[model samples]
Target: MKRLSLITIIILLPVIICAYTYTVKQDGTGDFTTIYDAFTCYDVQQNGGIIYVFPGVYENVPLFQVTPNSVNIQIIGTNKTTCIIDADYAFYGFEIYNVNSNLTIKNFTVQDASIAGFRINSGSYGNTIIENNNITNCGFQANASVQKSALICHGNALIKGNTFIDNYNNWDYWAHEEFSLGGAIYIDYHDASVTDGLIEITNNDFIGNFARDCGAIFATSNQVISISGNYFEGNGLLESTINNNVPQYCVIARFEDCNIVDFNSNICYNNESYEVQMGPSHEQQGLVFKDCTVAQIRNNTINQNLDLSATEGIKGIMINATNDEGAYNIINNIVFYNWDGINCMNDDYGSLNIDYNDIHNNPPAGGNNNYVNVTQGEHDILYYPDLDPLTFQPIWNSSTKSRCIDAGVPNLFDDDNTPSDIGAVCAIKHRIDVVDLPSPSVDNGLKWLSFPSLDDVYSTSSYDPDKAGDLLFDILFPFEDPELEYVKHENNYFVRQWQGNWQGTSNIFSKTNGYIFQMNEAATLEISGFKVSDNTHIKLDGNSYENWIGYWLEETQTLSDAFGDEWNTGNIYSIQHQDWSAYYSEGTWKYKTS
Candidate 1:
């Protein structure tokens, strides 16, 4: 640690002491009432801390301007679904322009942003993170061609772990000099800085985003652009306009003039456009890269259910590399079920390396030029990727191991230390059909029961991490889940088994004891979160009706042995059979064996 001078310490003491955390709860319990007010507060603007938005709708709010040169600001929401920013078509959700301070926005459901959702224009906020948000339907529904997108970034920002859906622009404008672009996100960082990866877009899901150009994400950057581990499905339009020469086409992603591009491990499925055959070219597939110095497009799975009417061209990967020194390594990808596979354009300038790819089942697949290079080792394949029908993941064949399994480049190992799979690291996902409750029990008409969870519930990263093993009422039984007496919960005793009565008036939820709940007729409630694994000492009341015991230990033990230390003579009845239980009476322990 570097020692600071006395003068430096004196100068920094005031700023260090003034940091504040502002809470925005609509119920008048927090520091501020609205999100705008909490963010615009003097203390938050000057000396930044977290502006924690509790579970409630912050409706009709405008941009809370970010003051330059402030400390790191973090605006967080309690839950993505409950903590809503309903723009009501008034303004964009949030914006931070030309500030060096690291800003983080997480866990909010932003809806109906008339102009846009989240726009982070210029700045080297290298630590600027926007994650776990649901930004949906945020752009102009109908407008002339203009630069409107769900998220627009000019700086090197981290856009990760978010869901962007239906941020469309139904522009019918005639061809103009500038085209409306990037329905979901636009990384408009053009030669702003050569600093690599100020704009890292990874692990995001872009679904059903429509734009005249670059339906999902567009980046024209001199910096290193990395787009990995993302799911782009149902983006762009299936129907194309009957334009003779529009100079605008739809694509999941388009990167132009970037210094370096790293696009890997992305799933682009069923993103198609059946444009009429025209002299003007259109990209109707996963990605389009133009004029990038260096590009590594690897490990991507692009599968399109070829529309029979698709005429012009529907390619899996499209590239226009004109730079003579540019190096493009297009490898280890599974491109199938489309009209065409990989279309490398103007490659006389750039050195294009195509190898180790499973490109098959095109109207000519594999390589467009049989459609694939059927040669061995480093060359591409012209075979079928045996995939499960229900879930589009690749399947492992007992006889003749699947071509997709060990088809990737050698030495690049997977997480399990085996040779990597070809397509986007897919595993067969198990699906359980949705089961509906019987409105009320046909036998007794009782409703509420207990948590689907058995162990102690823990806090999530979106929620406060401080409440690690503590499950508060607001955390588990959120108010938005409808606490309408006896339905979501029976009554608010909170805990029944703990020896000491928890502060009923306070917000603390007893961790050691099991609880009871009463469902209304029968309603759907979803509760799935982290669980604490460490041993916790539980104080039991030992009263018959007071306990709802749980199997908390890792090893199985006899109920008599586990609770023999405490005075116990109670019946343990489960919902399966009200009378079937372990009971103790007349100095003998009885077990109702399953």
Candidate 2:
């Protein structure tokens, strides 16, 4: 066989690349003017590549379909806010059926569809990524009687960092039957086993989505599902005229057969119904097995969930399981300020282990009637966690730190060196130093001034001992007579004495550089010879005096050298600069001139 020359090989390489790229712009400037046109023109089965959609509104288009045998095809929008796909009267926004793996749809605003925003059929089984998109106002059909969702994924996928809002199904609005499963997302595996890799839903935000059943998410017949770091707010709203007796849930995962579900590090707040309703709600939750084996619910913050009915019972976490073979581990969570904290009903068949959780302020916190059978763990606290008002994070206040610090399980470690905190956020300590003047004391014929006390100083310092000792000085004396005389005492100290007629020369005490000068009127005097830390809160004569100091009264050090960590630097000093305008440098005091 003859080998091809270098020039011939280079010529054929371009044709054999097996990938093609196209662009879609609403303004007819890109390779294609519409997204439907790009999909129809590209031979995705033979060469799979990306279709980049610029920022613009593409309206009234058919379903953006990914044909079968299309592998590694990505439809990406430039921006989620600006790149809009408006399917006002279309059946669906995107339909991926029996497609090859690795299909990614990201960074787009998909809205106004009749059926759903994205529908991934069962045959597609790659780690498809649906991320950074805004899915809203879809799944509204009055005539059709079918369950609807913003996104329906039958294949293995990772849905992360997406926003689902205002998506609803109005079948109940016209017809008597309620056919709404999930307003935001629905994950269905039909009959697939748990061996399929888990479908991960992480870091997504679901808000204001409404449905009859599960408003935010509904997962059914899946092997393993991991839902973490997601925020669910104001979901699970039931129509007023419709059947209000049906239970509405923000997150519902029901597995008919044996499976493991891990739900952790999520925030579910301000929803209109149950925050989490897991396991089969049927069977009256007796001793019979419903196939779910392991459920780990930990590190979540749930709060303020209310139902439409004024007298209804709302729960932050409601687990109804009938399987005696299953094990439920609920630990290290914050379920506070809600209507009910953990309602575990029909959990007698399963082993319930609830421990290390901060559950407080709920109407009736954690009861067997509510489905929480806390057999082994410690009871939840009733005090407030002292969370930050703005961020809702646990602040470093004494009430929060004393109870939550190092309060997790025996083996698990917190972010700090202590044990884990009993909530989603760990407590971190912050140090602040305060300095202020001490009270004056008199002994014999002399009066002495003491140094200021350091407040909230916890640990020992590595600064020089001599410099620390020199921070205290005695220099004040009382003068009661009309004529005052200057006298020199032992240890080079100076004193003020009463004279009958005349006073010593002005230059007598002037020669002593360390003597305190007594003045009739309030004058600015410079006094120096002490070391202090910068950034310290200083007070003089029982008043705040931080503005009069020229330079840092305390020695400055780098963050690494001061804290032994690279996060905080500079010493904080609070010095009271009253009538004296003075500062210290190199262990010496100097008065500032007016």
Model 1: per-residue lDDT, tens digit, 292-399? Answer: 888899998887635644544456777776666677788888887776677765664457778888888665323343243222235677678776654556664333
lDDT of 1: 0.64
Candidate 2 global TM-score: 0.62
Best by TM-score: 1
On lDDT, the leading prediction is: 1
* Model 2 agreement with the true structure over 248-268: per-residue lDDT tens digits: 343333333436778887877
Error of 1 at 446 (Å): 72
Provide TM-scores for the models: 0.63, 0.62
